[model samples]
Target: MAAGGERAKPAVQSRMENFRKVRTSEEESPLPFSDLPPDVVEMKVKEGSKIRNLMNYAMAQMELKGRRQIVFSGCGRAVTKTITCVEIMKRKLGGLHQVTKVRYKTLLEVWENQDPLPGGPAQNLTVHKNVPSICILLSRDPLDPNETGYQPPEPAAGLQAQPGEAAEDVSGSSSKGLKRPLPPPSEELLTKKLQVQGAGDPRGTGASDHQPDHHQ
Candidate 1:
């Protein structure tokens, strides 16, 4: 009886598989493009033509917008989406379009070179041939006024300071102006201090002494 039931299950599975394949084939059938009305096709073509014309007009306006720097302010997601859309558009239309991907560091560098002052206008910008398809200016949320006018901290004065040594100022400052390095205590002195501390305390010096009695 078991052998018979196993054979019947295979037959049932094969039938179900055939039904699924038929259903999938019907669903995958191409749409009746030829059966569409002549008027409907003409209308769709006209609509597409109108849309293309509108896009061209908008692009022309953008190109003619002059050499003013554009500041886009939004949340991270919106800003990213805007940058992606701009990049795609630039890729479609090639020309003197300049799209620079500016990160926080690169943006600062650009600003430092062009205008060091806060919220100052960038100057003498020339579009090079190697400019990216998208100019992504990563910025904080525009809605949050607190983030505006904030500057990144300056780098440390000394780049090659040792672990125990005081770093000299590279900004033409006197060596005497640098902080004095404190001398490390001798190993023997440290050991003696530890021994004295352990003797005074009832608990032992090691970490195990500080551990709670697990038996309790």
Candidate 2:
């Protein structure tokens, strides 16, 4: 009876294994990109385009409206420098207000355009070029020194004047008057003072018996 029961257990185990279920392909998770809606994908691309446009418009507005100093700089290439300037201009405008009505321009397009600030006929107009990085102060004419009214640095005497001549003093007269120079120190006195200080005497007496007898 025991032998027959053991033989029946093996047949039952085999039947259980054969009946076990297997998962189908449909049970796996859906891919991330595949699950996104078609509309969402289209909107993402459009949003990128709008951001670019906003940056460009801000760059132009910064030159036209804000009138801030425009500085362009980048490593490696001129195109990179142009893009950096545009992007910086965008951020600066965005900080002031919401980015709206912005127009975007590519590096190649910006290069083909004239200098943002032109001379002569195109005063107050800017012309961008593929030259090295530079800080452009907006001016009507490149030759006009007073156009931008940029203050020249003052001289060491706290005066601003044309080169070669000293500035005018409080009397409105040119400061050409010769000022008295400082007198030189006597070296003998300076040496004596230094020697006394370096002697390191506690009472500061240089071999003088100025103290009373200690026994008293």
Candidate 3:
């Protein structure tokens, strides 16, 4: 009886092992490219880019736009840089409204190799990877930031240009004026002048003919 019971236990164990299975489902996340608003100003950030330059550009853009709104976006390793830029801007241009968004992007990889069996077709493998992304929106408008928390920063002059640092002042006057030296007259201008000179004289002796008064 003991031997029979042990054999039956082995059969039950094998059946359980064969029937056991794991089921998993992944949540699909889509990028927010299409959902971005057209009116909002956008700036794309990369990981290896200079933060100081980006901060300057961002500050200038905000000053130029009448809407007083700007957004920064980044993916993968660049996401942290994007946030850092926003923080710098916030501290510099205080009294700004803020909005933030996060999402994941999926990447795919495929590989093909020869099959173990001789003269068989190449086998292919597929893989999927998800990368994170973020977007930060800053504005001075009185409305909500949509899905992102909004905390208005207090007004400050963090980036105010000093006497020697006037280069950062966008709205300030500069010694370098936009007025450039007038270029030499074009051929058309010379032709117009000749025509005027010819028209002014009835004798058809254009301005070039300044007859000399001689004693006859």
Candidate 4:
């Protein structure tokens, strides 16, 4: 029993030492956050983050708060996802200036052999890799210059005609080149000649009053 215990103690101690070394390396591996613009809103994306959640945050800042610029940043596998979010936002909002930056991030990886052959010491390997990273900048004017610019569906653009405008158009068309029929004449104001000509009255023919000429 004593011999078996002695053999197991060194392996356990070696694993603990390997764990400590790995923790120290990983702690020192990550690079500091890059400098970003103060005026723009910066969003950091990760693999576990959902697109919908990120979009909501972006909309609140850009559309609701009227932010002029926005930036999307991601590294490693998240780089593609970050690009996708930016594209979707651009299509929805429209009229934005876009700029992209590519960078690399270095990650330190640690590999250890916990169980080694008898009489062989445990080993740890540290590898450094550079991962791809991306940053996208989108900017737009605070005011909308184009009437045809895309608008989000959530808030209405007021496409329907206004009451005042409709009234004015109606009045304008009625006043231009539009002739109205005169109102019917009153019985008391009607003239004899006018009444006679109105509907072929017998008095209008005047032949009834013609007298026969005398024989010469």
Per-candidate Cα lDDT values, in order, are 0.35, 0.35, 0.66, 0.68
* Model 4 lDDT tens row, 1-216: 999999999977876664433421212222222333456677888877999999999989998998877888887888999989998998788767666667786667777766656898867777777888777777774323232322323222343346667889999978863744543567436655665665486554443434333221
Roughly what TM-score does model 4 have, to 2 decimal places?
0.44
* Per-candidate total of colliding backbone pairs: 1, 14, 0, 0
lDDT of 1 by residue, 1-216 (tens): 999999999976764343211110011122122222232211111111343453454354445643222222222233444444444444444332222333221111111132223687533322222211122221112222243332222224332344325333443354444534533569668878888888887877654465666445
* Backbone clash pairs in model 4 (N, Cα, C under 3 Å; residues 3+ apart or in different chains), count: 0
C-alpha lDDT (0 to 100) for residue 149 of candidate 1: 34
lDDT of 4 at 54: 99
- Write one digit per residue (lDDT tens) for candidate 2, span 88-153: 543454322111111222222111112223453422322323322222222122223343323332
For 58-158, candidate 3 gives per-residue lDDT tens digits of 77777765557788888778899999998888777778877677887554555444323367764555566677878777777654534455555654554
TM-scores for every predicted model: 0.18, 0.15, 0.45, 0.44
How are the candidates ranked when ordered by TM-score, highest leading? Answer: 3, 4, 1, 2
Among these predicted structures, which one has the highest lDDT?
A: 4
**At residue 208, what lDDT does model 4 achieve?**
42
Off by over 4 Å in 4: 1-39, 108-127, 142-216
